[model samples]
Target: MAPDSTPPTNEATAEFRAARDHLLQHRGDIEGARRLPRPEGAYFNWALDWFDPEAHGNDDVALRVVDLAADGEVRAETALSFAALSGRSGQVANWLRGLGVARGDRMLLLLGNQVPLWEVMLAAIKLGAVVIPASTLLSPEDLADRVSRGEVRHVVAESGLTGGFAGIGGDWTRIAVGEPVAGWLSYADSAAVPAPFTPDGPTRADDPLLLYFTSGTTSRPKLVQHTHRSYPVGHLSTMYWIGLRPGDVHLNVSSPGWAKHAWSNFFAPWNAGAEILIVNQPRFAARPLLDAMVRHRVTSFCAPPTVWRMLVLEDLTRWRPPLRELVGAGEPLNPEIIERVQAAWGVTLRDGFGQTETTAQVGNPPGLVVKPGSMGVPLPGYEVTLVDAASGAVVTEPGAEGELCLPLDSTPLGLMTGYQQDPERQAEATAGGFYHTGDVAFRDADGYLTYIGRTDDVFKSSDYRISPFELESVLIEHPQVAEAAVVPSPDPLRLSVPKAYVVLVPGATADAEAARSILEFARGRLAPYKRVRRLEFAELPKTVSGKIRRVELRGRENELHGSGLTGGGESPARGKLEFWEEDFPRD
Candidate 1:
């Protein structure tokens, strides 16, 4: 398909038509129609539009990546003007073309947050190749699975990771960075070629741009596919959410190979023409990251809740940066984390919600009042609804907790095309003309969406429904608690009760006294129905991508406290152990 150079107009395509109707009926009957405005003649082809050598002319500092080493040494600094990056990536594109890398071929990229990563990314995008970004942390077993299941035709990785793909099969072309490998092309050599590329075919807006093998938290990795128009254009909402402006330096703490990386690093900032600032480090250390932000004069920032929680453990008052905005994603941000950061920095931390399948669906947009513990309202282009799981119908009544589903009618540009090669699963997911998020939320009367746990994570105890997020939020408010994850533990009498796994802050001892204090803290904060009856202190299990694995925690609880509450059910009761409603005024 040829690229549509006629420009997007007021005309409503089928996806747009359906999306508009759904939003009008549910979110804003009158104002919804006016909010969704299409772009005119604005092409998101980074190679052709932003990275043109002649277009940029002599402008320096198009992108700058900073590497803060683990040994407290500054490793390298890479700055490429718009002209240089474009020309270098163009040479890489030409080199790849010579090596039989055709347009739309799947290429697996396993590299760190380095200059070559961005260069190769632009080159592949210009050549119209579907990139599968893999983390350098993957083992041979993981590599073989992706190579076999992802239908990859080319392998591009750092020299350190070349041995990890030792026995991977197929006629996959090998391209290595950093060092020479037998039978593999050295990526360093691509720079020596002619620094210009001419495309053989026009690029389509809806062409498949990226193929991601999602981090399998529960099941096998699913290939999540995105079109050129979907991600590059769709992240406009993300730019709006972060309040990113041109020339603003934005740093996002996310690893490569994940969707969040592309969400913040690639499109969101670039969409607003902001400088993408990166702090590349071997191991995560809070002080170095904070110092770099101050040195770079970073204005906007985003991080997963895990990183935020870790940072709060240190003395936040010890460092100050020129930060204007801070945002959290990947997981719901607890109210405690927000409060701590705000108290220290005088800047409120906002939270946004989305999945691997889409960009910022719900977020606390700029100029909006961010409600504590709520993930804010739906993004401008998304028509989000709380649909009843049992009835399979949209729930309009306020305070009704239901599955978070996006209507098919709201054809947001950021949504994935479909799960690659899985029609049956896709059909089940997109049932009833909606893309089911599999997550639950409750929209309050004022229109803010409070995240309930995942559909499988929410459960009932003694006929009372429980939201782990609600309890966990309250748990973190305790001074000693650094992070918390709440889930149902089986009980014979109550059927199930909320159990908490907590990480303590610095100087907080994991003793019976501390546990008791946290229990009392939760008792005062949460209602009787949402009390944390049992508590344990242990490192939370997380996916390789850093998402808390509640599913795994739930399994551990079931194994330990089978079928009911018992005195011996607790796992080495850390800190001071205390129970809610035990000494409280009970009805």
Candidate 2:
């Protein structure tokens, strides 16, 4: 109904589309745009209401994926138009319906970045099924936990990954994509199914749609439940944050099964009617991705800090894609990387803040003046309040730090209902009359929020709070250091001191000289209290998603090689390859 500027048939789509168009029209008006219209309706279905209506006769490229060719210079591309995908998904929906996939049935999707993944996502939405998008990287043990906890009724997995489910006890429907499996139904059969599928009934706005498992870095993964409108409608804020526009070729460097993949791939760009581009390589080679961006005429791009860090290492001065917006998420982007990218591309690498539990709450939208080290103000329809965890005081003064939270009374549309089957955890999240983000940030005088670190990640040194991210940001600015993770090391006098576990760039020396130079660099850039006192040249542990697992490093430091109460708190004997600041001369 909205494709040709016609009136929308669905009340939810009408309300969502209105707010979406408003954000696009007034990209610069953050305050005005933040006052987004809430959907006032009893029933809503994004696939049926938004996608189908918007797909009518639309021939624009909806999705295009590129992989590196053997030559490595050229990209092998596959594209699908909006109308084509709409019809394809419709056929898949009908086929899946015949297989007994019904409304509210929890379906697990275990696949990679293939066309079938997108088709299945749309088809599941059309069939009113709850989808649990899972990474192919998860172990069989992890899959077992998800199956048991998620109450999965059906699973759509690649043929290669079917082995992981062999021992899992369940009569769950098994469907495979690619090469014929002995007992699993083939996804190729959907191609022969008739189109023009019909839904059983209208979907209530609060009906469950997506169930996400948080990437467990610190603890066990939490099951985050989102309604039909929560993710489908909630991503309007994400759309606005990314500065998406109709016909824009938006490329988000995220994989299947992640909330971020759905955020930019399924909802946010579609909310803005923008084309989604996915780039795949046998291994992450920045040149191929760079070539694809230039070849496809990419307009907007979003990648995690890991990708951004890798990208700046390439000779970016040579390739200038037609990118208008550059965004970073999944972690805070270092100022050094942002500066390097801006120097080459002349576009600011804007950072956005959100979680698996919600959509984009805050961001540096396109055209907003970039504030170095800040992850912008709140997005549309979100009212953010920073709360002090210790005293339960609302932190209003600038430069003050607190936990980012949403008041329960004014909950935004993007937030999850709660962690599924975990009442105690959910209770803790909603404790103190606010939905606690568990992450901490500091607000500046101009309302820009600079992310400090996770509540657990932030530590104290000599009664002064130390933000690992803040210190890590400065550490990466050193020419040879590629990545860094800071954790507290026990000390007698200071009680604890900042110690950095550093990873050096390729071919860089991992010696005392390198450590001294890196430490000197950080000491010059950081305050005395924040300076890393102990440095070790070692690899940082990461989740499968490429997030640094500081918790692991903290464990290593706490044990300190199982040395118990030695050295009278002066200092533990320096471990192999570890360097203390006092080991080097001040000169």
Candidate 3:
């Protein structure tokens, strides 16, 4: 179908457009963008109020998914224009309504990166149903927990994943996306429904829209609640951070069911009227990924630090993508990785900082001076502050480290309502009139923030504070190291010392020589007190989302050393490939 010859104009859209344009106009000027007024109103439904109107008769390709074969060859491809998607989602919405799905009902959406994921998201929004996105990697146990804790009233999952929910008990409707499932409704039947979906009622700005289960790295996952305005309208800051523009093809390498997926794949790019490009691969191969980027001419790209680290291992200069902007998030990008990419591609990989509870709060937006280690200043619409961890007072002196915080006095629209059903935890997080991020960082004189580590991840050695991220960053710079996690090793004298769990790059042997080389490399780069006293060669424990679970490593260390006594020996625990500083002969 052809796009509408002319775009529709309305007051709500105009307000959103104005706010977006203001940020784009001042993309390089952080202070100026922050000064712009935030968009506000009572009644707003992004799908109906913004997306439908913006997508009407819009022939521009809004979504493109490139499928890769097992051999890393491009097998099949699909593209959906904005107008077609708007119309299709309407049909899905009408069909879902016919199935007795009502407004404000919670639905569990479990699928991979496919067309139905986008269709169902839009359909649920149009129907005013709350969505809980679950990763396909989730186990049956995980599904049951979500079904119970999320109060899910409906489920939309791929046919292959239906079995995972077999033993799960829930009073929800099951809708399958692929081939025929016996007891579930077929999602393919939505096409038979009519277009032009009509909402039962207006979607209020504060209406519950999404419930996200955070990746449980330390404890059980926390249920985060977001309203209609929280993600849809909130990602304006994310769009600004990525420097997205209308018609730009933006590709973000993130898995489905994560907040980053919604941030870039759904809200950020769509809000900017940009095209979302996806390359579906059975497994990630850097060569195939770069080929897709070149084939699609991806203009703006975002990926987690893990992807960036892997990409740098390959010859990045071989493929000169037409990328104008590159970003790294999920974890802070090391300075070495950023510099290598800059040298190869002539484009600096900007670092961004945010959690599932919020949108892009800080980032190295385009046209700004790229800081070596800092994750840039606060993005537009966020008033970021550094508060002392102990005193709870805002830290004004530069170079002093503190807990990163967002004051509740001017909470950005992107911030989540709170941890769902956990008022006590919420109160603790929001204590002192601040939304404590529970992350630690230090600000420079120029207001740039450099991530130290998570508050819980930081430890003390001989009374000196040690940030694992700082040590890990230096450790990865060694050629043999692919990934490293730092945790506190119990000590009888200094209380605790930094210990490293190292994952060597392919072809690197986990021998005493290799361990000595890594420890010596880090010893020269890190301070005396922050030196990695003990080293082990093993795969680091990680959350499903790929975040290192340092807490698990700490527990293992304490469990091994029950008495917290090393006996002044070199190898504390035997048979675990453990290496210590004393293992090497002294000059």
Candidate 4:
């Protein structure tokens, strides 16, 4: 089949294309991109309206997955064109409809970075059903919670993971991919169904489309609800942040089930009509990942700070990648890591800031001056502000820190509808005429937003507010440190003091001398008040999505220093390796 020669003529397609083209035209003009009007339509189905027409008879590659074995050899490779994926997803949709799955049904989709994951996502959208994405790394206990909280009416998982849901009691329909499981419908049956799927009804823009369970870094995960327009159209900002162009090969390092996965893996790249590239390895090794990028000629890349940190540890100059754009998110990236990559690859790693509740609200768009430690200006379509947490007053003074908030008066299309089934929590989050991000930051005179830390993660020492991220950024500069998490430890005089949990690089021993070296390194860089008073050499606790759980470290510190009055408490003799500043000499 040849690609469609004629341009899109439908109303929805015209509206979407006009809006998308405006951003592309003004890719470097931030003010012009912000002035572009958002697409407003009563009825829109992305699968039916935009993707199907754009993909019709198109031979361009839509997705490519490279599977790596234990020894870093390519075991298998799969590439699906836009037209092929459209027809396959349509067939899957038809097959799913045959299994009694209907509009508005909640389906729990658990799979890895396989073709079925993309097929099922598109199928669910075409069927007008709500999709609840689940990671394959989830335990049985985690699956049970999602089953209950998500109110899942159907489940589609790999046959190998069917056992995790065996004990999970639910009335949902089971559909298995890979190999067929007993009592579960086989996804292979979808191939027999014909393409050209028809929708049951027109999809409303405000209808619930996706339910995402956030990675609980501080507390239990919250169910975040997104409407059809929130993510699909909202990710225009994300597309711009990544600097994606049509036919570009983009690889985003993220796990399944996380919102970032959907942000980059699905919506962002697809919105730009770019190919979604994946490097599927059982475990992440920097060399194999770089090899995949080089082989695929990936033009755009996005990964978390952890991956960037690991990549910088390797000989980055050895591989000459054709990457034109690079981005880091999930956490604020340190300047040292970004500088190292720039020195080796001559490509600056741009930082972006967003949450599960929204798309790329703030980012360092292409051709912009990226300030050190700043996550850049607000993306187009978002009205970002810094408001005082205590008084709820907007902070106008430059360099004055406050919680990052987005005004709801003219709410951006990217923001989530709200937390599902939790009206009180939702109300609290969106109170004061703004949607609270729960993260803190300060803007400079030039309007670049520098991330501080999460509201819950920031603490005070001697009445001066302290951002753990500020200290952690300095700690990682030391060659010995691989990863570091900062939390407030109890102190009688100052009420609280900064403590660091450090993970050493390979071959570095976790001993008194190592602790002294790290502490002294930090002391020379950080202020006296922000100095790490206590140090513990242990593996940092991380959420399933790989975010550091600072809350857990704070809890551990509180437990160790009961009543917050114990000045010099005895360290635990067993379990985690621990060290302190007093254990070493001041010099």
TM-score of every model versus the real structure = 0.90, 0.97, 0.98, 0.97
Please list the residue runs of candidate 1 whose C-alpha ends up more than 4 Å from where it truly belongs after superposition. 1-34, 39-46, 50-55, 563-587
Model 2, 5: alpha-carbon shift in Å?
A: 10
Clashes of each: 15, 0, 2, 0
Model 4 stretches with alpha carbons more than 4 Å out: 7-9, 564-576
TM-score of model 1 vs. true structure: 0.90
User: What is candidate 3's lDDT per residue for 161-258, written digit by digit as tens?
Assistant: 99999998757899999999999999989899999888898888889999999998889999999999888888998998999989899999988888
Question: How high is the lDDT of residue 520 in model 2?
Answer: 89
lDDT of 2: 0.89
* Candidate 3 RMSD to the real structure: 1.7
Better of 1 and 4 by lDDT: 4
Residue 352 lDDT (model 1) = 96
Q: What lDDT is obtained when candidate 1 is compared to the true structure? A: 0.80
| Cα lDDT of model 4 by residue, 1-587, tens digit | 34767634478778888888899999888989998678899877888888888898798999999999977899999999999998999999999999999999999999999999999999999999999999888999999999999999999999999999989886889999988799999999989989879888889988889999999998788999998889999999999998999989999999999999999999999998999999988889999999889999999999999989889889999998898999999999999998999999999899999999999999999989888899999998899989999999999999999999999999787999999988988999999999999999999999999999999999999998899999999999999998999998888888988889999888999988898999999999988988998888989899989999998889888887646444455543222576777778764
lDDT of 4 at 206: 82
Error of 3 at 28 (Å): 1.4
RMSD of each: 5.5, 2.1, 1.7, 1.7
Off by over 4 Å in 3: 1-3, 566-571
By summed lDDT, the worst window of 10 consecutive residues in model 1 runs over: 1-10
Best by lDDT: 4
Model 2: pairs clashing at backbone N, Cα or C within 3 Å: none
Cα lDDT listed for each candidate: 0.80, 0.89, 0.90, 0.91
Ranking by lDDT: 4, 3, 2, 1
Cα deviation at 95, candidate 1, in Å, is 0.9
